[model samples]
Target: MGGQENVDYSIVICTYNPDENVLKRCLQAVRQLNVANISTEVILVDNNSKVRVQDLPYIKEYTAGIPGLKQLFVVKQGLLYARLAAIAEAKGAQIVFFDDDNEPESEYLQELHRLNKQFPNVAAWGPGNVEVDFVDGVDDNIREVALQLFQHRTATTVGFAAIKDWQPCYPYGTGLCIKTDLCREYLQQVNQGRLTLTGRNGNKLSSGEDTQMIMLCISKGYAAGISPALRLTHIITAKRANRPYMNRLLYGTRSCYETCMVQVFPERKQMLESKLISGAKFSRQTLKKFLKTKWNRSPQKTFDLIQFIAAHASDYMALDKPLPGFVNKVLTSLKIV
Candidate 1:
C-alpha cells in the first residue's frame, strides 16, 4: 500500500457547544474558498458538545447545502484530544485546524497552501485573529493592520532572538495549518493514549495545548509562519469577552505557562525564570514609553495594555512563590479583586 492517499487539504474544526449560527457562518466561509488545484475536506470533530451539534437547525441546513464535504468520525474527548483524533483520520497532505467559532476569509485556504509551498520546511502557518464583537461593529481596519504585521514576520522563532516589532504568537488554534505527516510524527511521541500531545486534563480544564505544540515544533527544527492573506474573524459573545471572563482567561493562561515549564523544560526552570524577569522588565519599559509619549490612545486600548503588563509582572513574581497567599497579595495590590 502507498500509505493513506494524499488529498489536497484537510480542515479540522473542533467545537464544544458552539452556537449554531456561528458554526453556520464558519462553514459558509469555508464553502466560499475559490481554490481549485487543491480539493478541501472539512472534519468537524464535536468535542463532546453538550448542545448536540447534529440537532442544531443551522448545522442541519448548512450540511445539506455543502454536499460531498467529508464528515469524519466524531470524538467525545476535549479540544486537544478531538484535534489529535481528527489529525489521525485526516487524509490530506496539509491539515488545517480551525476553531468552530471562526469565519475565515474566502482566500484563507489558498493563502495557506501558497505559503506552505513557498516555505517547504515550514511545519505550520497561522493567520491573524480579527476579533468579532457581537455587540459592537467589526473593525476591519484594525484587522487589516494586524494581518499585515502577521505576514511581515511570517516565519520566526520564539525566545531572545525573536523578530523585532513582531509580536511572538504561536499558531492560533482557530486558523492554523500544518503538514499532516509532521503533525502525526510529533503527536506519536507526545501522545499517551487518551492524553493528547499537549496532555490536557480533559477538554474543559486543559490549557496551553496549542502553545505546547508550537514549542515542540520549534524545538524540533520546524519553522512556523503566518500569512496575511489568510484571515479569520473570531466570534466573541458578550459573556465570554467581558472583564471577568478575561481575568479568568488570563488565569488559565498563567496555568498554561506553568504546565509548559514543567513539561518542556523542567531542567531549564532557572533559565525560564530569568526570561520571566526579563519580560517583566520589558513590560515596565514599554509602559514607561507609553506614558512618556503621552499616546492618549483609546481608553480601552490603554487599559488593556496596562492590564497585560500587570499580568506579566504578576507571573514573574509568582515564579518563585507559587502559593495562593502570595497570589492573593499580588492580586489585592493590583486591585484585581
Candidate 2:
C-alpha cells in the first residue's frame, strides 16, 4: 500500500527534540538536491520530542510548498521505533535514513543515486559525516583532516569504509541508505521482536542498530558501501564535545559487541570467541596508537583518545562473559531507558 509509482526515493529522518534551526537547515539541504529522473519524498519521524516539531516554521514551509516532497509522517516513538514506522510508510524504491541534525551537501542525493547505479547489489551506503562546532561557528576541519588521515591509515575505520566496500564492523546511521523493500522486511523482523536495536531503552546514543542491520544485509548476500562523494555536516554542540560524552560514546561501542553476540550471533560459543578476538585486536591496535602519540598534543584531544581506547578495552572485557543484563543496567543508570 505504501508503494507509489511516482516516487523514486524516500528520505527518512528520525528526530527527537532536534534543534529547530538545525532541522530546518537539514530540510533546506534536502530541498537543494539535484532533481532529475528520481523524485524525492521526505518522511520526518518525530520521536516524541518535548518541543512540537511541526510547529517549526520550515516544516510549515515545506508542507505548503515543495512539490517533489511527499508526506511527513510523525511517529511518537523512540528513534528506532520511529525509523521503523517511517520505513513502513515510505513509498520510494530507495530509502535514505538521515539524522535531523545533519545538513547534507548538494551532491548528497546525487551521490547515492550514482553509487546505487554503480553497484546495484549494494544494500546500504553512507557518507562521511563532517562535524560542525556550532558554538564557535567553526567547522572542525582539524578533526575532519585527522579522521581522513586515520581512515587512510586503516581499512576498518568508519570513514574509510565509506569510500569503499569493507565488512563494516559497525554502522553509522547518519546519512545511511537502504533499499525500501529490504528495509521493510528487516523492520518486520524487528517489529516481531526478533532483532532489536540493542543497547538499551531507546537511548539514541547507543550503537548497534545500524551495524546489526548492515550485518543482516551482508548475511543475505547483499553489498554495502560508503560513497566518499556524499557528505554531511553533523552539528555538534559543546556538550557533545565534552569528556563525559566522549566516555559515553566509548561505552556505547561495547554495547555494539554485546548486541552482536546476543541478537545476531547464532551460537554462544562462536559469538563469544569472535567477540573476544575482535575486541582484543581492536584494543591492541588502539593501545599501540595511544602510546605512540606525542605528549605535546592538545590535552582535550589526548583525553578524548584515551577515553575512547579505555571504552574499547572495557568493551573487550565485557565479552569475557554473557552480560546483557549488565549492559542494560548501565543504560538504565544513564537514564537512557
Q: Return the top candidate by TM-score.
A: 2
lDDT of 1 by residue, 236-272 (tens): 5554444443444444444455545445445555655
TM-score for each prediction? 0.71, 0.73
lDDT of 2 by residue, 243-301 (tens): 34544554554445544544545544454455453534564555455454455455445
TM-score of model number 2: 0.73
Clash pairs, candidate 2, are: 162-226
Give the Cα lDDT of each candidate: 0.58, 0.61
Stretches of candidate 2 above 4 Å error?
4-6, 62-64, 68-76, 128-171, 198-204, 267-337
- Cα deviation at 152, candidate 2, in Å, is 12
Q: Give the TM-score of candidate 1.
A: 0.71
